[model samples]
Target: MIDTDRTAAITAVLDSLADAWARGDGDAYGAHFTEDATYITFVGTRYQGRDDIAGSHNTLFAKFLKDTKLAHEVLDVRFLGADAAVVTTRGDTYKGEHPKKLTKVQTYTFVRQDGHWLVAAFHNTQRKPLMEAISFRFAPETKPKAWPAQLLDSVS
Candidate 1:
């Protein structure tokens, strides 16, 4: 069974990651991963290692985005072992602009190493609400802006 403290720790890590991305703090964002972590984007592009991760962030942030909100609903968190966990979450990014493009639902897998929990793998998928929602209204509530908020947000 997962204790509250462990859960809090996990939450902290996830939050920091989001904060980093939202704030355009590449260092903070990359800090959440292991040295050789594997990151797979929603489009199937894979990047390995901290260097690649850092490079990706550098290239992304260098483009200049006014990063905004990153609100998510943590669907579930399950322990793979004493040092590993899988977190399933649904969320969307909102850029303060026009023609919204949102990608919902992201799954993250983290592993605790040497007393520190680091993300070992990350996989993001676009949420298909209408496909599962018989009552969901297909409405354009607002346009989405990829604000680069997928990086670290808050660790504690």
Candidate 2:
């Protein structure tokens, strides 16, 4: 049986992250992660520890990411055990209108710590739609089961 309470708690963490990003609060954003968390950006920059994440984001929030808000849709959430979960989401950062479709895929690993859920690791990847469509067209088996067939067909 699924533990709905735990699931809700895990998702609440994600909500908090989005809220922090919306406010450009790097400290608040990093607080959702573990002290020794590892974060890898889509551009391949890797940050070690919560402090690194927070400090780097503070720089970003002040410059390149200024006024940006993050938007995301949860794709999947699977419990590894009672205390751990892996979540997949589609997300993007935008300054104005929310994106019609998020262009990046992100994976988050959450671990329960001292009765609170926190992200232990995170990886973000930018999706290349053309490359994905080409791959899927040649290898239909590579398509995700949850993806609608009509979408691929239209792309092909």
In model 2, what are the clashing residue pairs, if there are any?
Answer: none
**TM-score for model 1?**
0.73
State TM-scores per candidate.
0.73, 0.91
For model 2, residues 44-147, the per-residue Cα lDDT tens digits are: 99999999999999899999999999998887788998899999888999989999878888999999999999999999999788988888889978887775
Candidate that would win on lDDT = 2
Worst 10 residues of 2 by lDDT: 147-156
* Model 2 spans with C-alpha error above 4 angstroms: 146-156
Task: Give the number of the best model, judged by TM-score.
Answer: 2
**How good is model 2 by TM-score?**
0.91
Q: Per-residue lDDT for 107 in model 2?
A: 94
Whole-model lDDT, candidate 2?
0.89
